[model samples]
Target: MMTEQYVTTSITPLESLNSLSPYEVDQLQDASQGGLFRLFRQCSLAVLNSGSELDSTKLVLDKYAKFDIKISQKHRSVQLELVNAPATAFVNGEIITGIREHLFSVLRDLLYVGTELDRRCSGLTESEATTNMVFHILRHAGAIRPHVKPDLVVCWGGHSINRIEYDYTKKVGYEMGLRGLNICTGCGPGAMKGPMKGATISHAKQRQKEGRYVGISEPGIIAAESPNPIVNELIIMPDIEKRLEAFVRLGHGIVVFPGGAGTAEEILYILGILLHEKNHSLPFPLVLTGPAGSEEYFETVDNFIRSTLGDDAASKYQIIVDDPHEVAEVMREGLEQVTRYRKATSESFHYNWQMHIPESFQQPFEPNHENMASLKLIKDQTDFELAANLRCALSGIVAGNVKEPGIRAIEEFGAFEICGEPAIMASMDKLLGSFVEQRRMKINYKEYQPCYRLKHDAEVVEEV
Candidate 1:
């Protein structure tokens, strides 16, 4: 049985950006193609649809087919009027405070990104430009907390996890919270939501009221994975690349759980950065963990990484199985090391400004059929470049699995063709097959279909 609820409410702005210039307000109110109204509408809908069980972006949009949001400027400030909104976002006919704040946050970030990209600040290069853009977005959302030592741990995993794994995430979160650490994640359900939910109880038990639960997402994914209610601070990046960059840059350390293609993309992104010759000495802690039943999952991930990127790449992170206390203890020690390293290196505590991210990782990856088929997935290239290509391959699989545009593209065309070295393709095929068998692809779909086909041709070898 599914819960069906609906509500309509008009909310006024709160502490941030309540005041907008008449021109700015008018621009937001404009729904024309050239205006910011469409962006605002899509994000607003996602915020209001928080806590939904739906994981398909297209499904969520279709369920609330009649939903609409209108922006109006008042003499004192701005107001949002929602029609046919999801009732789950309300209590007693009033919008949930957190959801309301998130709605406005969507407004705030969309405007800032629009303005910043328009100005093209300082004519920065691709890497510098991406870093600056991430900084600006975090600053706009007030996510950067100065004077606070590196303690924020970013958790990444699938939103459609099993009961035991979900509970294991919470246990890890409880341990982390008991140690007085904060949590950051993609802000959807399952593993993302589990840690925060567990931490809340532990925080209350420890009488710690200032714990932070930050959820970072982007426009393309927000609808599919609606911000869980526990996410007190929400920031929507402009795209997936920026969102992933935000996670690595803002977080002191990262803990990866068992997940599908999306999680693989995240692992590859971080490993690619760590594999860079310049970053070999950086003290960034990466851990892959889960409960006892999840041992096989981590083994598969380890095997895939070792077979493709080699043992040196695998040395960057540690795998701790079925022990939440050890996970938390190691994370605390790792974060303290991160703090000391930052001070020793004279790096900023809030952001990793010293980390070197190559242009290949910073630039956006468009997962079209041709681009997917053209990836250089062989081990002959440098480790960092191989990681980059592998990241793109996983990213394309992610798009095909749940993203609306990717799903639509598959429907219109056909399965995306992924042609690479025979060895690489075979390993990728095995990993993807494992994800499917474990049911990590989609939450509610009856049967999952392959959105991509692996093509191994000898002629492609010469081109590479």
Candidate 2:
């Protein structure tokens, strides 16, 4: 299946930003700090590597270290010149059509965020500005369909999963698609690709013309989790926090599949927001589901939440096991309630404007060693606050596992140190240990390394 090691092609826009101004092209040519050249090159490479089986950002870069992309000011238009690109992205000698569209999409989103959105977000408070940036980015990407009803379901799970679990995800997606639900995910392989793949078959049978398979991602992680082929619309949020916000604001319901640290990070992020007293009346339907033999996986997650966040936090989401049809039915019914409530409240059907996401959740969390150690993971804070810290802890682990910079951080320092009270640390230890034991951390690798270690004082002892 391997072709040439590299190929060069000139690419123009398909349905996005047909032309960039001279200033924009100049900025892209600049390699300085504020310039877009490096970001543009990295993202464009990710798009070209969309269909690749590789998931590690480090390996992907090392395999194609010579890969490069440049912006050229063609006559009356702007186009990209890719150099030494991946061979799988080509048919015969030319670039694939879908990859061409995706390449333009990468350019479109990066440019919008770098210039237009950046300029527009200058003078507002941090909270107001974040929401505005999310709205504008999605609007520019044409992700929001004002005329559509509540049908989009955001699927979250691990990129590294067993065949049984992956097949189970597709079955659930097929059932949901037959019921007229669109799909969204973190935009990678495994569970993310499975649902869209399943939904495409049913959508074709049902003749659903506008079945959207939106893939939301950010710059820091796109290299690690390349956008899957099924994503019709791809968005690159400014950071992880905004990416998480986009999921809650854009999706009518959420489907949680079995995953590892990143999946736990997502679960904690959503629970943190939904636990906000201000969001007590929110009608968001959160469902955790999996195939047969996955009972222990869900039990660990359920127990961890119940032990830390208590019954109130556990009540926000239902655990549905083994039955794809029932999962889809429950989600369908929940979305119906969402529709009725939104209609009654006169809220926008396209986005969840009424949902209250706290500023703590809204702010981006840097996963550096200093920031990771500074997280308050104890139970002294509110449930939402503890959830936020737990989310950050898992986020750091995700970074150290697959992200290029985080791997560098670990190689330089050591495994991240996470400490908390005895009870909370025990729960964290159990959850993370299960993830590693289940081999949910990485796929096709020889072994999974411990990117993080739990630190407890003499007064608080626990296994990590």
Candidate 3:
């Protein structure tokens, strides 16, 4: 594996994180409890492995088993020494500037999370406090701009998607960019990269030199999906929940591309937030669009949402197909609504402080088998609460599909058993089956092995 190809080099920070306190430096170097050294090392390796096709975190880690990164504390600055790093990160024996920046971003975020965040976030259990944590983290990472209008459109989709769908994302991005809208994404490959890549050209054509290409990722998932090169501004959140929160809080609208479990998780997360009673008056745009080939994919998705979350949930988002220009037009219209709503309500352009996120959505859902099995699938709870639980289920499947820990867990425990109301289970099983059959579960997938089992539904064939 090229991931094991060794390289040894010493690199200094180019701009951000030039200097660090001695206390911070010492803590970063320590591998003991409360040390951020290992976290920093893995994240750096992931960034260095950018543009990789591999999505299995375990495979990536195993291939680069001996990869190592060390920090050298300086008199007024800090430096990183790499050993056994992926050769792809370097061109002509120098790390690419974007990769270097992403590398430093990994360091900045992990350090902030390990050292400052907990102390600052301590004693804050309220939902608003959790949202506040997201704001402060983004503020520290320079993601939230004070005077910027509602222009950032957060695009969500699967890393494993077809060429046509990917192109559609780019086209939509180009249209949006021509309209002077910025782009934000989960910051990985596939749909995430396409829009930003498209927007760059459009921005250049429009003489817009200053553009924000924001990519937000979390440590757990970053290893599998490294920051795409198109991302000029990268922020590493501590966990997936916060990362999702950052997207909704900062972006004016959302554009969803065709994706698998991870995409499903994102859809549910936003719907859950929008379905909240407090958010009924708020004007956040959510458009689920794909290329012509993705009609069945979106149909299944829409069916699942309607079957479970009901017609009201289905009504919250518009399904747009084949026309990227229309997608951008809807986004523009939605932003206008958002802008008007903000002006009338006196809300900040940068942060949606008024949007109410339930603690269930804010609290991180660890995707272990036990947790997956315990997910509430009954319709008795509020629509928003049900959406949150459904989000957790999809989230667990995503973990089993890619994240190293979740992969290992699935291998050890067999497929995660999903038992719930029979109707809901049947709908979920059918939706996931469609994803697998259409090869949405992963890129170039020959066949998908089930990482989760719908135990309550027998009509679906069980993978043994």
Give residue 407's error in model 1 in angstroms: 1.1
Best by lDDT: 3
- Taking the tens digit of each residue's C-alpha lDDT, what string does model 1 give over 1-464? 32656667789976888877776777777889788887788778889988888888878878888998887767858888899999888877888899988998898898888765646557887679889989889977999988899989999999999999999999999999999989999999999999999899999999999999999999888888999999999999998889999998999999998899999999999999999999999999999999998888998999999999999989999999999999999999999999999999889999998888888888888888878888897878999899999999989988887778888888989888888888888788888889888999888877788888876874332110
lDDT of 2 by residue, 1-464 (tens): 76577888777776657778988788788889888887778777888898676777888888889998888776757778888998888888888877787788878888788878868888999898898899899989999899788999999999998999999999999999999999999999888888998899889889998888999998778887888888989889888999999999999999999999999999999999999998899899999999999999999999999999999999999999999999999999999999999999999999888888788888888888888877787878999999989999999999998888899999999878787777888889899899888988887567677888777673334334
Top candidate, metric TM-score: 2
Model 1 score (lDDT): 0.88
Q: What is the TM-score of each candidate against the true structure?
A: 0.96, 0.97, 0.96
Clashing pairs in 3: none
* Worst 10 contiguous positions by lDDT, candidate 2: 455-464
Task: Sort by TM-score, best first.
Answer: 2, 3, 1
Residue-wise C-alpha lDDT for candidate 3, range 221-284, written one tens digit per residue:
9988988999988899989999999999989899999999999999999999899889999899
State how far residue 434 of model 2 sits from its true place (Å): 0.7
Model 3 TM-score (2 dp): 0.96
Model 2, CA-based lDDT: 0.88
> Going through the candidates in order, what is the number of backbone clashes in each?
1, 0, 0
RMSD to the true structure for each prediction, in A, is 2.7, 1.5, 2.0
